[model samples]
Each structure stands twice: as C-alpha cells, then as structure tokens.
Target: MNESSSRRLELVPGGVQLGTGPWQRPTSPSWVLVLPQTVGLCSSDLKEVRRSRDVRSDFGHEMVGLVHSSSMDDFPPGLRVCLDPHVPVTRTTAFSETTLLEGSPDQLRAALPTVLDGTPDDRAAFTEPLACAVNCAGKVLAGSDVAIVGAGTAGVLLAVLLRLKGCQVTLVNRSPERLTALSSTALLREVPKVLISEVGTRTFSTVVVTTASLDDTTFDGAWRLLSRTGGRLVLFGGIRSDWRVPGTHVLLDGIRRGEDVRELELGGRRALVVGTHGATGADFAAAGAVLAAPLPWTAGHIEELIVGRVTLPGLAALLNDAVRTGVDPIGKHMVDIGLNQ
Candidate 1:
C-alpha cells in the first residue's frame, strides 16, 4: 500500500497547531485505514490535548468514515464505519475526523450494525460518544434521581442517556452558556438545568462527574450531591487530587486518584470510575447499533447538540477552548478534514 498523508492536530502551549504528516498503516491485521467523513469533538479530546499544549493530541473518537483499506474481510474498501479507540487494537493517538484513522475490525464486528445503514453520515458521526454515553450511563438503574456535573459533551450526553433509561437528571454546570446550550438541546429540553450553587442543597442517587474540565470542585461537590448511604458516584473524566470523603461515602470500584478514599471502611456508598474498564468489541457493537436506532433521544439529539462545523484550518479557536483546562466548552464540535483537498 502507498503511504498516506493528512493534516494533524498538534497540541501547542495555548492551542492546536495544524500540520501535515504521513499516515502509516502498521503491520497489524485488525487495523484498517479510514478517511473520516465527520469527526465529532469530545470534551475528552480537549483534556488530552490540554494535557500539555507542548504535546500533540489526535484524540478524536466520534467519527464516521469510509474504510480506505483493510486486510480483514469484515472491513473492506468503500465500507462506511465508525471507530472505538478503546479497543486494544485501536489504542493509538489522534484518530478522529478528517485524518487517516486506523480502525479495529473487532470493534466493527462487535459494535456497529452491518453496512452503516439508516443514519446519515453527520448523525452517525455520534456513534463513538454515544457508545461512551451508553458505557457510563447504562450502569445506573431506572427511577434513580441522577446528577450529572460539568455540562460538557460527555456530561450532557450522560443526561440524555440516563433519562432514556427512565432516570430523572439534573444537569449542573458553572457556565451559563453551557447551560443555555443544554436548555436548547432537543434531548435535554425537558431535563432540569441547575447551576453549581443549586446542587449543594439537593441530592441524587447517582452522580456522574462526566466533566472534561474543572475536575476538582465538581468532584467534591458531586460527592456532596450524592444522596442515600448506598448511592453511586461514577467519575468518567477523572480527578486530580486525593481529597477525602469523610463519612457516608465508599469507593466501590474504578481508578482511584484519591488517598484515603481507597482504604475506606464504609459498607454502603459506592464511588468508582466508569472509564477504568477499557472499551471492548461489545462496547463498539452496541455503540454502532445505538447510533443506527438510538432510542429515546435518538440521532435527532446529535442534530440539536452539534453547535458548529469547521474545516481543518478553521479549527483554531474552537479547539483552543476545547483544550482549555477550566473553561466549560459547549456541545459537539465537528472537524471537517476537507477531504476534497
């Protein structure tokens, strides 16, 4: 196969720097080269890029593209597909939209339905994050009162997904604009929106700290917002410190960024990180099917949540905010690789 080249989203000190690079296909059978049609922006993409502006990050998971080539029979040229970067075979960096993506056959087999049917390319682009929404929110049972902190893409997504499961959600964030975006969303229109100040006085059975930015205060606040002795707190975006939860909280399962929380002697409360378990082929398949026929909010939610569409060269300002640490970035921002170029 001839070597391919494409634009890369290089993380610089303040924002993203775009440059061209060769798209090399590794000598792995499960991997296939894909040219993304549309890549959905994720808050996690911001976190990884913002991990250090000095570093480069290609962290795009939400995209739908055509298979450029594949050694595997299941994935062939002209086949339309999405990616699951968490699949062990797909753990490389920077494979979102507009660039050449190395995809996973296991993910194709397990996650998506046959032939990217029904959904449009733009709507189908939500496959990966919707899969993530399923992974995180599917854990909570119906009828639970849930509080999702951060109001970013993931947090907003969790709100929609959890509500689909019959849970009542209270979406909280510090940014009024982000809250405004939520209020206008097709899926979250009925779900209540609350400022951070409003949550301390109330409680929930499950609290998903799915925020991509501002991990500290929300982390402590989410713990306080969780109600009942056995309530669950699932941290998806991750926390920085080892802050202790004095009483009535217990570490159930997940990655621990806390000190004494890991050694707690409690019996009822459950606090664990949902992302601790890596994405599997099953996850990918379920994600694909969900996008094809997403229930409750469905693919229509993708239409309402998509705030902007920009080509590679025009992504500077949006991506800069995307990677900003504390600033809450709005809904899904897609990158059009301008493949026609």
Candidate 2:
C-alpha cells in the first residue's frame, strides 16, 4: 500500500479553503493510522467556521474509518472503527483523508471497533452523533414523557433513541417536510408528530429544544410544552450567541456556572432547565454498540437521516455557499471520501 496524502478543510480569510499536505504518522509506538471513509459535516463545524478568524484546519469530527496500520496489537490493521472526537487528536481534525491517532492505550481505547462487519461506511458514520444523543438521553429518567422540538438530524435521532428506550416522545417541528421525512421509518412512524402551531394544551415531563438556531418563540414554545410543576427544559441544540431568550438568561448563566439543574420562571410557571453538549467516551462506546447490534429499526435509523452526500471539495462548496447565503441546508450532509478518489 502507498502512503496517503491528507486533504482537510481550513478556515481561511473570507471563507473555508481545501488544504492539502503530506500525512505524517506519529513516531510513538501507540499511534494508529486511520483512513477516514465517511465524515459527517456537523452543524457545530459550520458554526466554528462562521465564528473563527484564524486560518485553521482542525475542524470536522464525526467520522468512521479503517485502521490502516497500528503499532498496538489490540487495534489490528483493517479494523473498522468510530473515533471519539473529544480527544485532542481527533477533535475537529476528521476532515482529512488520512489521520494519525496518538494516545495511551486507554486513551486510544476510545477508537471503538463495533460498527457491524458489513455495514456501509456511511451508515456506520452515525456513531458520533448517536453518541451525543445517548449523552442527552442519560439526563431523562427511563420511560419519561419527552418532547423534542426541531425535526433536524439531531432532533430526529433524539426522538428515535428516546422512544426505543421506552420514553413517550413527541417530535415537534415547524417544517412538515422534515416530519414527512421521518415517516419513512416504521419506528419513527409511531412517535407522535406535531407542528409548532398545533402543539397546544400538551405538556411533557421533559421538553428538549433541538433547533440549532433557537429563537425566542421556540424557547417560549418549549416552555409551554413543559409540565408546570416539575418539568425540565433541555437545551440540546445550542442557541445563537446573538439571539436573546426572554427570562432564560438566568438559567443559561447558572448552567455556565456548572450547575446541572437551574430553577427558572417561564410564563409564570416555575421550571427546571438543563443543558447538554457533546458526548463521553462511554457514550461513544454505547453508540457503537447500538449501531452494531441487530435491531428492527437499525437499518432505517442509519439510512433515513442522511439527506445529502458530498465529496471534500463539494463540502467546501457547501460551506462557501453557507457563508455567502448565511443559511445552511436543512438536513445532514456527509463528506464521502470515496467520492473524491
């Protein structure tokens, strides 16, 4: 086999740039070389590009790759794996065609090898985002009544994962097209789907706001869906820094202080608001298991959510378009490296 050159997304002046360079392997004995097969372009990635001014290439984390070579015996070459992006080496550096992962055996243990043997690379790439949903699911009690606002990728995954866990979940979104997309899967077909205008007189034990760009009206709507006595509002999708939510800054401030739960007043009703971001190593492992295991909805779960696929250069084009229009496409867009070669 020949050594591979690396191509990655770089934050440049005016917009994003496709950067090329020689792929370097770590001299350390524990390092592993990975050839990324499929990478998901997360909303967080676009946000990072939109916010930063420096020229940087370390961005793009959701990936499924094959271990091209490994110094450690545990991770043999050719093993399919999903990387944990929280680690320094893999964080925001997954856009490349090749990646060199370096860490202690325990640290590198996050490179979980449980994407089912015959699963398509694209389907397996769902691990990272699913891990995030697993982390959020941990907050709610088992079988709790839940409402998820925003029917985007994260929101839809959250609904499916929570419903499988025995929670009564209602998926609420303003867009019927997105909701219609969910109906294709039999599992999601059972979950109650409601539009924002129709979500009246219904309250949940926990309400999760999964809209990437949250506004005041959505925030208020989420509050209304929460039970007045002890309902919990989860900020799963982040709020724009420039946007303000009335009566919610105090809760946001408390969350920044490391408080897991904060008491707040919404619509004159007292409620608890909690925030969740990213995923843990254990969550990553669990996500891998969920994908690999045989389940009724596993196929649909992995396949239905992907709305579009692009190559590395095509990804740059999408990012450029987002920069120009100030709007991103409504669904998940994957960067398939095979499309490039």
Candidate 3:
C-alpha cells in the first residue's frame, strides 16, 4: 500500500500516533493482504500503548476486513474475513489500513474465512471477542446459576450468551455507568446486575470474572459468590502483572498458564477453578454464526455494544487522553478505518 492512504496506529512515548507509511508486499503467494474495515479498541491495546516508550508490534486484533489481494482461489480479492490473531496465522497485524495474513490456502481458509460476508463491519468486528466469550461459555453447564464479575464488554457478552443457554446470569461491576449502559440495551434490560458491594448473601453454581480490575476485595467478592459445594470459578481475565494474590497461588498459577486449575481451599472454602484464554477456529465460526443471525433470545445484535466510533487519528487522541488521565472510557470504541479518508 502507498504511504498516503496507508495509515496505522503507532505507539510512541506516553501515547500513540497515526502515522503514514508504505507496506511492502510479501513475496510468498500464501500471504493474503487485507484492508481492515473496522477494529475494536481493546483496553489491553490502550494499556500497552500507554506503557511503551517506542513503537511496537500492532495491538489491534478484533477486526473485520476485505481481502485486498490474494493468490489463493478461495479468498478472492473482495471476500470478507474476520480474523482472530490467536488462531496461529503469521504476520497477522490488524491495526493498519493494510494487514497481511500468512498461511497455506487451507490454513488461511479455515482460520480466517467467515460466514459474515455481508454483515456490517461494525458487527462483524465483534467476531473475535464474542468468540472468546463463546469459548468461556463452553466450560459452563447450561441452566446453572452464574454470576459474572465486571460488567465491561466481556462480562456483558458473557451474561448474554450464558442467559441464552438457559443459565441464570447476574452481572456485577463497581461502576454504575457501565451497568446503566448495559441496561439501556434491549436484550439485557431485564438481566440481573449489582454492584460488587451489593452482592449480599447471594451465591451461584458458577462465577466468572471478566475484568482486570480484580484485587483482594473484588477477588474475595467473586469467591464469596460461589456456591459452597461443587461450584466452579472461571477466570476469564488475566490478572494485572503488577499485582500479586497471596494464599491463592494455585488459582493464580492456572490463570497465568491459561489452563484449568483443580479445586482449591481458601479459608476452608472450596471451589473448582477453571481458566480460559484465546478462542479456537471452531469458536470463531460459532461466533460468526451468532452475530450473523441473532437468535430470538440473543436479546440484541452485537452492534449494540459499540458505544463510540472514531477514525485512525481520532483513535490516537483517545489513547493519549486515556494515558494522560489514567482513566479508561466506558464501553467499546470502534476504529472506523474508512472514516475521513
């Protein structure tokens, strides 16, 4: 891609920049060039850009785009794809006007192809994260009472998916704005939600923590919300690297490894702990289907989660503001690549 139209979000000291540059074409025919249409701005990306002193690799995953150039027959130049970078494809960077996907035809087709061909870019972009929630939901037994700590996008999506599967879901968060935003949605209007301090005397068969805001108090709240006997705890969010949880070594280790942990005893309380990270190819495919055709009980389409949309340069400013002020904006922010271009 030429320098004029090839803009990307670059990490610089204290913030980010929307820089223009040329992209060299890959020599291998296996590489497919994609023009990103929309990308979901994840908190992890903002956190990394905030801490970095120099430009690093792309942090923009959770994207949907059209195949701009491809030698493969299956993925033609105009075909659309939703990429989950964790699916193991090489050179898969999403935070740019142009990105490359490297893999064999079969591999690329299996991992990148989507059922969301005509779906709007904003909705299709949710494939990656919803797939993650799908992966997390697969671990829980249907119809079991479940509580999700943290009402961020991840927690809200988890609550919707679990509720659709017949599980009773209660979403908990410390922030009222997030909960209020969720309630405004048509699908989750009636879903149960409470503050971390308001989860009084309530317990569930399963509890999932979906935010990185967990500390001693929040962690203790999550633990207390579990049913005393045979309850399962799913750690879906990674703990902040700077914080350490003592006396919960087993659970912490499993979270770090992204693997399941056995039952653990905490002050004579016990619950089976399970950890989940990235999504698989099958999970992506399922997520695409869920977004493309919202089931009757799905409450609302994935597009409802988008709270703000900005262009590449606008995204740079948003990151800088978050880093400078040390506070993150609520809800999902989508980067509209085609805006003001």
**Which residue pairs overlap in candidate 1's backbone?**
12-53, 58-94, 110-285, 111-284, 111-285
Q: Which wins on lDDT, candidate 1 or candidate 2?
A: 2
TM-score of each: 0.78, 0.87, 0.91
Error (Å) of candidate 1 at residue 144 is 0.9
Candidates' C-alpha lDDT = 0.62, 0.75, 0.78
Task: Please list the residue runs of candidate 3 whose C-alpha ends up more than 4 Å from where it truly belongs after superposition.
Answer: 1-5, 52-58, 241-244, 251-253
Better of 1 and 3 by TM-score: 3
lDDT of 2 by residue, 195-289 (tens): 98898898899998888767778888888888888888887876654455585445352352242777787676787788787788888777767
- Model 1, range 317-340, lDDT digits (tens) per residue? 667755565563456677775356
Ten-residue region with minimum lDDT total, candidate 1: 256-265
Per-prediction count of colliding residue pairs?
A: 5, 1, 0
TM-score of 1: 0.78
On a 0 to 1 TM-score scale, where does candidate 3 land against the true structure? 0.91
Displacement of residue 280 (Cα, Å) in model 3 is 0.7
Top TM-score hit: 3
Candidate 3, residue 132: how far the Cα is off, in Å: 0.5
